[model samples]
Target: MLPTLDARLTAAAELVLPGKPVADIGCDHGKLTAVLAASGKYPRVIGADLRPGPLAKAEQTLEHAGCKDRVELRLGDGLSVLSAGEVGTIVLAGVSAQTTWEIIEQAPWVSQVGGPRLVMVPATRHSELRRWLWEHGFALAADRPVQAAGRWYAVMAAEYTGEVRIPTFTECLFGRTAEWPEGAGYAAWQKAKLPRFRLGVPDGTELAEEIDKLLDGSPSQTR
Candidate 1:
């Protein structure tokens, strides 16, 4: 039997481009890793975790899937387990936005020309992650909204563009997902969190008003 992925992981996997090696960073049970390897799309598949327990579970998952020899499991922190250009796609799932940013930030090579693609599913702070990526020279190539276990999540695929720009609050919140089938639910979920996000910012009032107009079906001034 092959490993199976939930709706969230399935969306992440779909965003992966073919023809190059792929790495599942923080690969907990390696279900996604096993699936990727079984697909035979990429030349190589790697599963890396920071802890021994998760990596062990990942090993078991790969073994059961009969693709154990197809995946390389590494024990290391973040992207340190692999060298630059080793993989063309890097997956970071089931982690907080802050944690994902920290991992990508540490691996500057992913921002260089011809860097690997990034497929991320941030457990929290999705808007913040989009903004961070935009300001750091990474561009959101695409995004898909998916619901799993009764919660809506966005799976974003980004690539290094080396063009840093300030994104509007609305753009940060939406991130090319406004047209997806589950986009409305994800947007509403993000809208509900704006109140808390506004509490600590200096331009809270303006930002909140702008985001409100955009989310309320008003024509957005900024894309």
Candidate 2:
């Protein structure tokens, strides 16, 4: 593992196919990219961000990991610095789901075969992002939640195959509840988060009820 990669990177790494090239967007400190390179998963890892400061820091991280040979740092907004067919996969973490989806929408190169695939962990607007992906062409490849430093986060992987239809408004908000780490633990977890999300989203009225209704409708969970 790269020195700076956290548990989220670890989970994302597990889902990535080995020997592919990857573009790490918003690669703060280049930690995740470094880890992917060191793990010998992606042949080349590109650490990209808009600011020179983060790129500089990422350069240092790659150097520290001695995976610098396999890593390249690019300074640009989203995937702008990368050319078509340059990267095999794209990883965007710690950004809003809206930005994540928008970046994908803007980058025509990503739709190419053997081009950039995307894995994103949006900081917020997750519901919107989920809806966007399904409406577009991507389908959920993996979904798992991890607690890091006392905060729970969902790690989502998606691939754009074709017209991914959205089933309902609730499904968009909750995602594939059939696949939501089915378990009693997850249920308890959601119960705890409801009040918070309710309090957080302005006019979270229908949103909260939908959550409760979704939970009740879900099948039995695991231990």
Candidate 3:
């Protein structure tokens, strides 16, 4: 039997394009990797982690799922485990936006044209991550709002478009998720954080006000 992925991982998995290989980075328990391998949609599957302990756990997951031969487990930091173009889609989850950006930045090839698609579920700072991706020559191709474990999360799928531009604050916060089914809940969750956020940043007050208008049912014009 294949491992059942949680709501977040299930959304991440759905964003992966078919036909090419996929890699699950920071695959803590390797449940997602095993599930992908068992699906047999992709020709190859890889599960990589920066730590030995997690990689070991992933190995066991593949074994128990009876898909050990279909998935390759690698031990390395971020994208270092695979060469550029080795996979068509890359999944990064269970990490903060800062850490996710650090990993992607270290792998310059991911920003190249025709690079693999990125499906990321940042544990925090979704706005910061969206803005970083836009300014760094990537575009938010797709996004979905997933409510799991009583909290809302955004699954961002981005691709290297080489169109480096600064996104508006609303665009950063909402990305392309406003039209999604669970977008309202995700927006509400983000809005609830503004007060605390306002306490820390210099422009937090203005930023909060701007987002407030959008969250008030005013349609956002984000790209």
How does each model score on TM-score? 0.92, 0.81, 0.92
Clashing pairs in 2: 19-41, 183-221, 183-222
Deviation (Å) of 45 in candidate 3:
0.6
lDDT, candidate 2, 79-127, per-residue tens: 8878887766778899887788788878876765455567778776655
Compose the digit string of candidate 1's lDDT tens values, residues 115-200.
99999999988889999999999988888888999988889999998999998888877788876878778777777776676666
CA lDDT, candidate 3, residue 18: 95
Encode model 3's per-residue lDDT on 1-223: one tens digit a residue: 6788889999999999999999999999899999999998999999999899988988998999999999989899889998988999999999999999999999999999899999999988888999999999998878888988887888999999999997888888778887787887777777677666655655557766675565566546465
**Candidate 2 clash figure, as a count:** 3
RMSD of each: 2.1, 3.9, 2.1
Clashing residue pairs for model 3: none
Each model's lDDT comes to 0.88, 0.72, 0.88
Off by over 4 Å in 1: 195-205, 212-223
Runs of candidate 3 exceeding 4 Å displacement = 199-221
